[model samples]
Target chain A: MTTASQLTPRRQATRARLLTAAAEVFAERGFHGASVEDICEPAGFTRGAFYSNFASKDELVIELYAEHAASLRQAIAEVAAQPGLTLPDLLERVVDIWTRDPDERRRWYLLTTEFALHAVRDDDARRAWQRLQSQIRKELGALIESIAARHDLELAVPTSDLVRLLTIVLQGGLGQHLLEPRAVRAGALEREFLPLLVEATTR
Target chain B: MTTASQLTPRRQATRARLLTAAAEVFAERGFHGASVEDICEPAGFTRGAFYSNFASKDELVIELYAEHAASLRQAIAEVAAQPGLTLPDLLERVVDIWTRDPDERRRWYLLTTEFALHAVRDDDARRAWQRLQSQIRKELGALIESIAARHDLELAVPTSDLVRLLTIVLQGGLGQHLLEPRAVRAGALEREFLPLLVEATTR
Candidate 1:
């Protein structure tokens, strides 16, 4: 009779190892290029253990997507909640969060560009992706409202449009990193984008 | 003798048929999925004919890229040359050129996302894509300069950054179209993005 409290630390360690291995394998070989054997070997696990933990590669990918979406939400929240921060200041913080974390960026670019396509084509994967993106959209929409209130600004466009642009720029920047990594200076995006963003909101 | 202008009307029709067929196959099935057989089938051409016309799929894709890039240049040139147009009017023209052309948008999105990845992974393809993009950047940069001059606006940032942003948004908007075909409203991009453009360039 295994109890909830009785789950072994070894199990947690193995789960972490599998996730790290998944991220690495997915990054290098891609979702299609990397096989289950490739991922398990990196994590020092056998096929049986891999199956025991994750039903399949698809299942593991879904879990990773959820995890990443949650963390992104947290990052945005951290920036948005900063006391006395202006709209541009908060936007800059969001840019900093994305560009500064290389590991996060790597996993994100891979999942969004490569894996997300597969998800879009597959029904189950597409639903999961929609759910994650919906959560992100909700959080971002709220942040936009908060900023508008704090700044006493009415956006020339809808808030949804603003959030959509931010997401596109963030994803485009990540994809660009995969192609030309050197161009992704940490503070460069905010420097270039914030003034325009402020104008859009204030107008 | 196979003189430069000696091609018969029948030969010209065949060439046009092959090009049209190839475009459809590339858009619907992607570069990999659309084999020589698939393209030739739609055109009622044999493998020998396909080989005679196009040395390889890579060459065919390069030609498509060239055509798309050329059309974009023409669109930008027309927009920039429009006399007595305000900045907002110029931007509206740019957005229309980008989003309203259905066939061009389909081919451009497919090529940029899937075909560009194929190019990035292969040195030969990378060179071909780079050449196309360089041509595009040069034309866009020139058009931007013309617009700035007409408006007497001294940009705070480099014109190169504006071009980069435009390229990223074009690709990103196309990407969004794949998921939600109606996401990119024709005039809305100009409306939302022009304020930012003015701010970046004006003061």
Candidate 2:
């Protein structure tokens, strides 16, 4: 087996392309509906190329989750590093990133929901998903704590609970907005609900 | 063609059984993965019986949404009729009805998510789903108005905005709990988040 260090940059780019293609095809055709051939066709890669990078579709999904999470953390860090950024500004920036691409957002939402349903039934997948979720919660909790300290805001609840609530609102709002876009509108959570939550939690 | 009034009680019961079974099977296998035969087998009905009750799976889904919404309204009415119940009590009671059966709740969540995804792509389905959602929001707004009046509570936001926020929180919270049951817990909305929302909105 070729070690990670042994892989050339060109090979790494091929793997990344395949993963991105898999995400799109899976979102469009669903996990069970989309075949490896379908993903390969769109990405201009062969079946062997897919297998060389990931073991199976399930493995690809886990990697997709990791990639998405990493980018989100990077975005959060970028926003946090801005000078004189308030809680609301940070939230709005993050929401902009999330709601920036409606098509991509919808695709991601579909894939995530599909994976979540699958994870609930599969023990190993659920454990892996939960680990990622736990890490996200920890990162969010730290960010919220830092914001509270920077603003001298008194949090009404634990930082963990606040993070959990934020996750719930985002997931829930996205689901609703996706289903009823005209009513829920894009950025409803960031524009309306998030402010309410922040104000309620902070004295 | 049989008129609605011409149908006997037995026919009505059969229709109800088929719907309930469809909800369960659809939840388990999803809209695309499930077939008419699968739903009929569990409900002990023939394909003819299934077709007689509903034209297609999409039609049955619309019916399921109507039935669920009707039952939710009934529950809200029952709760509202209780003597001397405060807003929090009513909210808690409603949440109880929602979170009462985890299996059923999980099934509903899965089916709803599936339907929502389907609706995004189908115009007719989206309109039908939106009508039901609008009615639900209106009913909720009315309920909140009455509660505020009875309790003489001053709302921090408009009644409509509050209703919308409540829907967001419920949808958001359910999505989180479904994915991370151990961390979020069942009824975390009713027990933890709803109270905070009520406190935030009311003085």
Residue A81 displacement (Å), model 2: 2.7
lDDT of 2 by residue, B81-150 (tens): 7889987788788788878788877777777777887787788878877877777778778877777777
Residue pairs in collision within model 2: A172-B172
Number of the top candidate by DockQ? 2
Chain B TM-score of all predictions, in order?
Answer: 0.80, 0.82
| Interface C-alpha root-mean-square deviation of candidate 2 | 2.0
Off by over 4 Å in 1: A1-21, A34-62, A79-92, A119-127, A147-156, A181-190, B1-21, B35-56, B119-124, B181-191
Q: In CAPRI terms, where does candidate 2 land?
A: medium
Worst 10 residues of 2 chain A by lDDT: A1-10
The fnat scores of all predictions, in order, read 0.24, 0.49
- Tell me what TM-score chain A of model 2 achieves: 0.84
- Range of the 10 consecutive residues with the lowest summed lDDT in candidate 1 chain B: B1-10
Q: How well is each residue in B106-134 modelled by candidate 1, as lDDT tens digits?
A: 66665567766665456776666666666
Tens digits of lDDT, candidate 1, A77-166: 777777899776776777777777777676566655766566645677656566556666777788777767777877776766677677
Docking class of 1: acceptable
The CA lDDT at A31 in model 2 is 78
